[model samples]
Target: MMFRLESVDARQYRHKSKRVGWTMAALLLVFGLAFSQLLVQSFGSSFWLNALGVLLGLLATSLIFAWWRRRPDMAEVRYVTRLKQHLARVSAHLSTLRQASRQGDVRALDLLAFYHQGMAQLETLEGRTMDDDAERLAERLELRKQRQLHGLPEEVAGFDPAELDAFRRSEPRT
Candidate 1:
């Protein structure tokens, strides 16, 4: 089952449950050790020290175990944030391309190249960008090509229009 902390009541319940569970476990452990120590000190000799030693050792091991369990959450949050930022950067580059293209600036070609490179990297990172957006981008590039027939012709440049169509077809719809 998925744990949803989306609502205030759910968040409160999780917080309270976690606090109660940890508190109860700690109290039980402390009482267990205290009882063991008292029994050993009263009914045995030189064994309360050993009991205390064992209790302390278990406490240390439990702490290490808890840290191990919690460490992955931190790592996952870090990577997810990084991936989100990377996606934003790619989108920003695409925006730069669009703006430069609108201004009829020659540098827009360079920006378009950079945007394609960024998209390639994003594809490798998570492949999560919307397929429709990619198709629109490819269509826009095709329109730009027809408008500015100044670049090398597709035949002489060994550029296959079919490849662009193939890429659009291969992507999954959003």
Candidate 2:
């Protein structure tokens, strides 16, 4: 699988790579020493056997290290996966809001608010602009709002505090 290091810091990448490299080297060294000792005992200090063991050990270590170095660190993988999932959720929510708005439903206004909140969350998470979808939704919401207001009398165009109080009083208290 393809791996990306773009989300990870350079220093952290180097530190983790070094730690893995050292751990692998230590394990190889221990294995090489034990194997060489066994070879010597079996063959009575044969020069060729000892040399072959060292050569194979070095080759294996190099190959493993190269493979490990090419792979992305675990932390970076998790971070990128999380970011993708979050963006997917944001896109889905925006699409739902757009559909609701197209139907001219009054409840679209509340869903639009939720869409804006999701965009704000995306912006904060990525430290970048997430306003494209939100801006489109805002324009559609504004048009709907104006159309709704045009159909209403001036006296009923604004919020009614008495209505809010009545609704709140009707709700059962926890």
Candidate 3:
């Protein structure tokens, strides 16, 4: 199956959030700093100092917030979030999927995808990126594709306990 970083942290969802945050902060700061521009333009007051202050404040606040992201321990937070999502993904179907995997059923690929993503999430929490196991699996899959999966079902609409178990009972149980 084609997969890439299926297990990413909740933070990945917030990737564009930082830009939005910066834009909002800049807007708020700029609104406040507008007073300086007003002073400079209308009153002919010496607002150069205020202009510098506004510039400095914007840059400094941006840098400070960026650095603060490193201060808190978000490892557990991200892990818990990922765990919840994974649970939601496989909670009802986990056992059936496992049985499917043990039976060498093509439906097992869905199970593998779930685990592959979970591992990736764990790796991310550890300051790691890619799942090496997944890399190897992908490589093997690529090599195996030429041979083709000899007996995949014509239509796999994902796993269901009843559907998978019906076939599981027919297997030799080796």
Candidate 4:
């Protein structure tokens, strides 16, 4: 026999399952009491009617429980709304990064790298590509780096010896 597992969170599943079980149990208990009254009043003559009533009660309980479980919870609805808003903000930020890089802003390069790293992590989790525009930005940054290295001015001034020493000390050893 094949069993189909639901994809709900474990906590949510446990909570909902417990609630459904309790509801079904209560419904069965009430139906059992009512059926016992009918059986007693009929002098135990309506045997088939009693069995039918029990089956109908079970069917009603199952249908109600299934309907309740199938409805979307408020928490899940709010979560999806927030997720959509966050994705929209990310798209806008990525567009801004692309525009800034296109204008030859060096700071945009660092920002793009940071953003790309974060998107790469998300891509790994989601199993999809999230860097279509990032690839072009990366290429442009590489070209700009090469240009800056080759067009350097001679005798660069304002050398900070302390900062240089600190930076060197912070480097990882090979």
Candidate 5:
């Protein structure tokens, strides 16, 4: 099941898997109460023992539910932090790629490898960003892909203005 990690201000929030699990869990309380009632009737004991057992059962169920609810919140924070760190690492690797590509040496192959890795990481991060940030930098990434495509051609010859124009158009404005 897809779980949405919602953010409140800068903090994170997560749905507690709805009340379905809670309802199922409450069955433990129901069974305990029924068992307790049966025991009270069969043993001719005072009502307090059965009542206490039922109360303890309810308390245990409540603690389990509370723990289950907080679980996703903890997981959400970890997931977000890991994503942010991954993005940072990808960005740093891309910078190294740009530098190596500038040198125009055999190391360009290494840069290409890094570029491909960075693109994969960027793709993953794109899915996890805030709504308004979903498509951020995607256009630039497409332009980068187009530039790589153009660079693959061995023939440039004289500077054709049309080809230059097309290349310029494919690149990010800034």
Candidate 6:
């Protein structure tokens, strides 16, 4: 069975995840401290039990934070996941989407803008900002500068909801 997920805000989710992870780690430390103190008070200086508490707390903190870091909702995964979601909604994959965009299809243009943005983000994640990728840059320039979409901007940095709105309004309804 398939389940639909509400759209995720990758930046917000990541920020919140970091906060929660830190909070959890802090809580573990506090619990360990309290546990150690209690053991010392109840057992007339229990070194081994205190050490065990510290060790367990550290293990839990590491394991939990590692799991949180690996969540699929991270910004890195979101770039690709969101693109796939958009394509799936329109029953198109990367190759077909690219072909449609090349033909100047409206929906394709919208999706292509997202694809380009995702590619750029992926590049940033890979730590290759200074590297000039000739082919990718050329394609973006060709579309944004050369294509005259009657009422749109000459340089579209990313997908614009208003562009679609204007286009839809300009065309007469059947």
| Cα lDDT tens digits for candidate 5, 117-157 | 43444344434443255453553454355446546432111
Q: Distance from true position, residue 161, model 3, in Å? A: 8.5
Best by lDDT: 6
Give the root-mean-square deviation of each candidate in angstroms.
16.9, 16.4, 14.4, 19.6, 16.9, 11.8
Report the lDDT tens digits of candidate 3 across residue range 4-93: 233334565345335546665875587547756755677676757577657766666677656654544533344445455554655455
Per-model CA lDDT versus the true structure: 0.47, 0.52, 0.51, 0.49, 0.46, 0.57
Best by TM-score: 6
Candidate 4: global Cα-lDDT?
0.49
**Which stretches in model 4 have alpha-carbon errors above 4 Å?**
1-8, 39-44, 74-174
What order do candidates take by lDDT, descending?
6, 2, 3, 4, 1, 5
- Estimated TM-score for each candidate: 0.29, 0.33, 0.28, 0.32, 0.26, 0.38
Per-residue lDDT of model 4, residues 1-174, tens digit only: 111111234355345546656878998767766765676577665767777667766777777766765576634323333334433443455555455555664444444443443344334433456457776556546645633654632212222234323433543355
User: In model 3, which regions exceed 4 Å deviation?
Assistant: 1-104, 129-135, 138-172
User: For model 6, which pairs clash?
Assistant: none
Residue pairs in collision within model 5? none
What's the residue-level lDDT of 37 in candidate 6? Answer: 78
TM-score of 1: 0.29
Q: Cα miss at 112, model 4 (Å)? A: 38
Off by over 4 Å in 6: 1-92, 153-174
